[model samples]
Target chain A: MQRPQELRNLFRLPLPRSFQLGSFPLRSHLRWILIRIVIKTFCGLTNTSIQSLERNKVASRFEVFALRLPPRIQPFDLYEAILKTNFRFKQNDIVIVSSKFVSISEGAVVQIDKIRVSHKAKVTAKKFQMDEKLTELVLREADQVYGGIPGFLLCKKNGMLCPNAGIDKSNIPRGYAVLYPHLPFESADKLRLNFINNNRLKLFVVISDSRLMPGRLGTTGIAIAVSGFKPVIDHRGEQDLFGNILRVTMRAVADGLASVGVALMGEGRESTPVVVVRGFEVNEEDRKMNWQDLAIDPLEDIYIRSFKSK
Target chain B: MQRPQELRNLFRLPLPRSFQLGSFPLRSHLRWILIRIVIKTFCGLTNTSIQSLERNKVASRFEVFALRLPPRIQPFDLYEAILKTNFRFKQNDIVIVSSKFVSISEGAVVQIDKIRVSHKAKVTAKKFQMDEKLTELVLREADQVYGGIPGFLLCKKNGMLCPNAGIDKSNIPRGYAVLYPHLPFESADKLRLNFINNNRLKLFVVISDSRLMPGRLGTTGIAIAVSGFKPVIDHRGEQDLFGNILRVTMRAVADGLASVGVALMGEGRESTPVVVVRGFEVNEEDRKMNWQDLAIDPLEDIYIRSFKSK
Candidate 1:
């Protein structure tokens, strides 16, 4: 029953100021916008070897870059950087990084050989009349795989959706597999703390990845994990200059910004993995971002939120 | 895996060679950096109705009358006069509008009794655990009523996330309700075509609404529908200045621009519905907008793209 005017009294907290990104020049500043204005990026990778030494070496190599940013800037690790570099970031600073790197660093990547092929993966593969190469492996590693949709396979381990069975091939040298970050939100929290303690500034962090949208021709970044951020920006109760209060106004700021930021960074070759954003006209104060922020409760989500399957 | 490269690509689409906006205080035409910016203000007539309408003729009462012009020696509404009065609009030229008027003209506003509940609504009411008084009526008009995760009841019809069980109580008559434009995209297309054909210019139309996000504070404008514009600018697989090929990069040009454009117009008592955006350097080729462009498919989505609830 409430419209824009009624929204005035509903705030559990203050609204984050809006950003004036258009004020910046489009040429050189575009990347700056992606990095500085960008938020997070996620990725999944397969490995040449799952050896602990290699893993540590890769983490260490990433660490090398992490230590290189201005101490004012968050460290390179998405989690640690956000937590440690909070001060350098502002209320609307963008924390852009890849999820593949995060997953690899957190040891989410698992050995594909160790997974046990399940009877279901075997049977379901037959039922869908599809290949068992990947499904067989999924059956072994998955706690439960649902037979609902395509492009994504549900695993029993966690309520996560990833491509190639959440197994990556990017950073992984040749044959090894990887999983998601072991403690995603924890990682984000750690990074959140890092930024908070390092500097007196309030900041947020996002662990993101480059992903495909089922029916679209392009891929954008999505936050796998986040802290000190609001995933969606609502505008349900507000007015325009025309004396008209708007209805049904909400923006998926995280995803929307992630997509733009990631696009500025390029998909595979560009490794400018860190984006530090500042100067937003709107945003949260001390709020922490979580899965709920990026995801619609289905209550607020309209299209994909509900469905009728045959 | 990718991000946006240089905006030199803004020229990729057929676009004007040059443009500018706003007027400089001293400079006759270069001062504001804000030309054709429509400032809109809203009032609820349900509280005052005919009385308010008596004072509410928009074109006459709400138009910018007393504002001072920097130095442009001209009779005002130059932009509006040309766009609205002359009914001339071009391609690639960006038009910012209020969704409300579009809704009103489209007959989106309706009487509450006109609604009908559904069986799913009953199940949803119980699932959402809502008060019985509201539940009975909610079920009728609700296209689908879903179970709540814990403490919320969700009712959806047409995939729009609305409250008051989707009943609105503002501006319109108290006994009536306003539904979302039956086919917003269609409405946008029709208007877009009129402007394009008449003005013979590359034009982009953005239908805006001011509303709240379920979990956040404050509200901003959102593009409910767009026509003749590239809503999203993707940069996946592009190279950054750092020579790294960005993995997942895409920019929500429309949404970002919308957020910023709405902010530039300033909120409240400023009643200006149409914002004429100029100086933005982009292209305008295909002048038709499809709702699908604004949505992401699950297959390519990172979250549930390949996942089912466990």
Candidate 2:
């Protein structure tokens, strides 16, 4: 399939190699206007919905729809499953798929009996009163292990703090555990490109996982992987209502979107594995986002940092 | 104004003093059926929409709409502002108002100039590089002071963990800082009753505040207080998709709904302070919920507990 980004490259307008520092915004603004006009003309020529294109510019409101799918025992085509739902994919729409769903689609499931019982895993499992096989899987999947409670380990996986490294034994069949989607960022990027190249529709994709927050009961949503947008909207140097410049008010857009999706996609037999969010527009960047965009270093985290001093 | 809960009490049927343990669900189910029939007949007798009442029984989907209001300079009638939105409040609809809005409406604001600083507050201010007056306010408001960073104190206020004891110097006039609602749970309960008594509509009210999670950027929504429903839906003893009994899978419904509201109510200059959510229904309870319903002891928290041993 031809890359959809080729269309943007075809419309590239070169600027002067050097410009005044203060003129950066004006230059970018001029470039944005030119791209908008070109894209508008292209949409008109191609009979695409101009309203959808315009809405992406200043859309504030959002409508989230849950797409329920049957439970799968084996890997299946996620793209075809989405199409089977008959939900029309629109430009700039956000598609949030559960990490468990993604794992199932990618055949990331493993039988508990198949895991090797490493000595460290066995010791850790004994201490935490967890299954040794699950402990091994968690250790293998985690980037860094912090600590554990009974039957669960709190760890940083893919720069996100989650218990059990986002592994799932609850939703799948007995004795089979599901690991997080192998290379989640790449998987999301590939899925995003499939939509873009096949239908000429650029949309965002988030691999979401439910997480328990500190000092709070129940789980909220966190984005394990994201594609087609900057995960965080940095609001540095922007004035608050009191006119003081905000230095640390970055909006974790991806995680927020994930939470919205998780609210609809329950962790039970409701069977909703996919959620389609429309009218939630963000700056669709071509550059692929990685873990750094949404997560802070554990040392820099207030909760983690405070624990050290104590 | 009459308390809205009296209507529920009027229809309370006496239950058998003792029952089989397995028959509890059945008894509740029968009671629920009876209540539904009575409410439906009552709606038929009155001019209420029976469809709205029926929809509450099985509402799995939700549509959140943001209601923008002008910035207030002083305390005003929150009920009237909601009425001014011209939004219809239906039975079981969830209303989420920002804590800042509630604080303003209740005049939970203080001028920074008029605060008396104690020795502890002065030491804290100097240590954290915070204003002495603001530190004094946070110290007073906090239930437990954990620690601090450069400019913010991490404290537990009303069973919620937050920085600066949930004090706000933003989104209001300069030289004034807004505190958390003096009695958040009571405020939410009172507002819910206003809707029920005035409009004859029983709706859920959530006092929401944006919270920054550890190791993540941007703030998601948390319900500081909720009325008309249990904040957490305990899935204990319920089977997961794999038929395994869930032990620690309670759904934080109020917080999830609040996050949906905060997504629409942007923290910037959007001016959206009220969000009306429809089609998301939970069991309506007459019991008033305190902070204990949603939060655990800090010592019991996994994140905090892990730190103690280290």
Candidate 3:
């Protein structure tokens, strides 16, 4: 399919009304060329250091396509549907699936009304000023609740620091909450194998979720599980532009990719459950890596250290 | 200017040796189609809930083009050079410029040898085992030095928590360090005005820098300054998918875009100093927003509360 033209048209939409170029008397196309020429001439006269613009093409280009799947679909079925898309998968293509999708597929949804609230959960709910049923669910899912403000519970679940153990109450049936997928690494591996066996393509799969950064206003992307790629790219011994060896520059490549994916996949009614990230380079040797490769030691975490005094 | 064809060829490169399809008997194209058919058929038989894949068009798409500029170019000159490119800007189009380029343009580079080191700098160098000259520079730039590890000084700079006050020693001339641009919001405004006057186009400009996130292994992008767009999109009081009013879901849209830009403009040898982000929606009223709009009150920050006991 001629997808590039469609992609190009996507970016060629008209500018907003406030930025219209109608102020120029000449036609838009001719005026744009004239403006470009005048700007180049002016720059040439003003800045002697200004040289010819290099046509050095972008070394890596990433195109994110959010694939919408039916609600409550199974994981294997969702994989098959994605494979059936017109967009073909190539080697090293990273398919980032939202953890919510995986959890729904894995039957991780909990009926809040079905839960038996404990005395501790009720007391904690009263103290936190939260719903009793929600507190019971949070208590069951959380490995440790560090406490929170009136409306939330800051906790650790599955070795991850999150609010309410990543129990999301959005986009599910009424009175039901979605849980983070259990054994996400296993789920990623299963999806990877499905892709390989069916399409004969080697692809990286990342199960992603959004989490709030400390002191940041909104949530950024985080990788819960990964398969067929190195989660971190260490640049400790790599030389910088000044020829200085970088000491603490290990890049969380997967997490960054997940952030890009999540940004494209809006948290609200976007319905974009799957995002295809192409053109990223991944190490072949690290194909067997899993979630542990992306996790940080809680004891060594700087934020955890700050909380130590408390 | 047939860029789309060029882009298509870029992704069509041969797969890696480990993932090559030469082992398969059938041709690559035919085998892929066959595999797709087989998967669809198998899925249909096994999963009754499997439905047709919906071709729900992507609501928003972003393409990042890394434009290469000469080293040590001035800010206005850099903006003029960007205007000289074939790609045209429109309303709400985001132009992300690296902070290093802005610093160099603003004459924020300081020669380390020119600094007169103080007794406190010497003591700090001895205690932290860093160069006295660099320590002096950090001391000058840092508003409050919280503490440090062996090599890094954790400090608050310009109302942001950063390391060494975002003083970078890489990608500059020898014996010099690049300081974060003075009044980044002002610089962003200047660039925005340049775009408006030259191309007669409205553009959102983001001055970006890389910073380490706590508990994360690598750096993510942060927006130091922005012009021509709202930095945050408040989703508070909006109904979620489950029809529950969202209490705290304000998104830091500019910061996420910066992260996307930095990921493309890699920290290492990739000389992409500017990235053009096209196809994002921005609020018209937010065009006049400054840095303060994106900042949170330190007293109200949850992380600050955790650190208070220390």
Candidate 4:
């Protein structure tokens, strides 16, 4: 559970520093009282609580823009590419980078010819009708290989559920595949730190990847790694509008922002591997998001647990 | 399969109609050839294919803004409230409305005192440690119930997986719960048509609701109903950057845009019920999204299959 003060930070309002009615001059106090009356009348007319007025004031400030980057054939300085775009970074702005972009920058490419298919890989490949070399890579990269479809291996990688252990054969040359970035959290942190130290701007970084949700037809964005802010905002202790204590209502801020980024960075070859989101506020900190904090035990997951009970 | 011509619409370029090289005047021919050379040179320098150049040109045009509307304490005219906001609806603008807003307008609130609990509701409620009346509502609304946790019932409602049959208890007065809107697809389609017939503008409408993904701690937005556009964009026949045909890469454009809308409309007391997305290029039509088109068989779902395989 988050501290009460921290939870209140989500709807922190802008008000006067002091409310000492006696200390204020008569003229100023009369003006303040008039302002409150106006606010109350407005809320009554709109059927809005004062809380919503403050929250919506904050909500309206968010701005998101996708940055077009030069396509990467090999590893290069990511910071330089961003700087070249002439997009000025502001304090607390979030930078969402496609995981594929991070992988390419880290030179995490694996040529198919170099991979030696093992006997296990060959058998699994045959069962799923997949390429033996690619299956070998999936086997090596995945923490646990659950099962597979014809072209995709259902696997768990770095505490996240994904297909083919987050390997990609698209947007790269033939006969080569790009793995998820090496030490993604470290990469995100390093990038965040680079901006802070070199540019003197505190910025958040998120490495995003696209995933197909169960029973859904298309892919949505998920956060692979995050730096400078908590990925999930815990709302367990908060009260709903009905005044019921919310027991399980955390906001997956990172994943939601990732989806926004991915929408702008089209799945096809758009070359927009980066997106900048401004004015959506979250507590900035020198922290890297841990997989353990974001993921739950598979057995306890509702979707998985339902199947187990069946 | 979608027609190949329709698939090509995703990345339709802004090239001139005439491609007959021999029929062009020499000056015009030289200009055309020069343009191609410049494009080729730019592509060569940036490692971007000409396809991406055209695609990014389209990607850069999206703009999203949330509209603050008066809170509805009772059933009211939705279209009237939208017109009250004084937002000029443009062609192809997508209007995302929170499902709660629609539910309220439909008088979908269930007063806890007015509900009668059944024997089965009592037994099921005791098992899940939930309110019997709410349990009865869930049982009544759900198409299929698949077990549950202490406070929530895992159920499929309207071909969509949700907790508690998508019944919401927050943001309303005490002792009352709001059910999912009646005929959500019809509501969305009617809203879309209302804008067209009255305002003389083509508009897309999506009724969005928030849901927690399996193993994820917080909620992301999902589209319950969509009008005026295909909710999913199929990319099956499109070529990847490597020139390999994409087999299964559908883009959940509606859901993605819904998530974007939810981010701006804060879950708590923020009274932003509608969000307008402008300049997002999707073919608009007089069609409502069907569940059969969005959902797949439960047996084929990867997450469930993995658990069953285990």
TM-score of chain A of each: 0.60, 0.79, 0.78, 0.80
- DockQ-wise, the better of 1 and 2 is 2
Question: How accurately is candidate 3 docked according to DockQ?
Answer: 0.18
lDDT of 3 at B270: 67
Which digits, one per residue and each the tens of the lDDT, describe model 4 over residues A213-263? 777778888888889988877777777655666667778888888888877
Query: Is 1 or 4 the stronger prediction by DockQ?
Result: 4
Fnat: each model in turn:
0.11, 0.40, 0.30, 0.45
TM-scores, all candidates, are 0.49, 0.80, 0.77, 0.79
* Candidate 2 local lDDT, B121-221, one digit each (tens): 99988988888999999999999888888788888888878788899887787889899888999999999999988999989999998887778877788
Off by over 4 Å in 3: A1-54, A57-59, A73-76, A84-87, A306-310, B1-59, B73-76, B84-91, B119-129, B306-310
Q: Relative to the true structure, how large is the alpha-carbon lDDT of every model? A: 0.44, 0.76, 0.69, 0.75
Query: Per-residue lDDT tens digits of candidate 2, residues A93-173?
Result: 899999999999999999999889899999999988998999999999999888878878888887878788888887888
Please give the lDDT score at residue A82 for candidate 1: 33
Maximum-DockQ candidate? 4
Cα lDDT tens digits for candidate 3, A186-283: 88898998988888988898998877665566777878888887777777777766676666776777777788787777766667788877666776
Q: What lDDT would candidate 4 get against the real structure?
A: 0.75
Assess chain B of each prediction and give its TM-score: 0.56, 0.79, 0.78, 0.79
Model 2: chain B TM-score vs. truth?
Answer: 0.79
Q: What is the DockQ of each candidate?
A: 0.08, 0.17, 0.18, 0.20
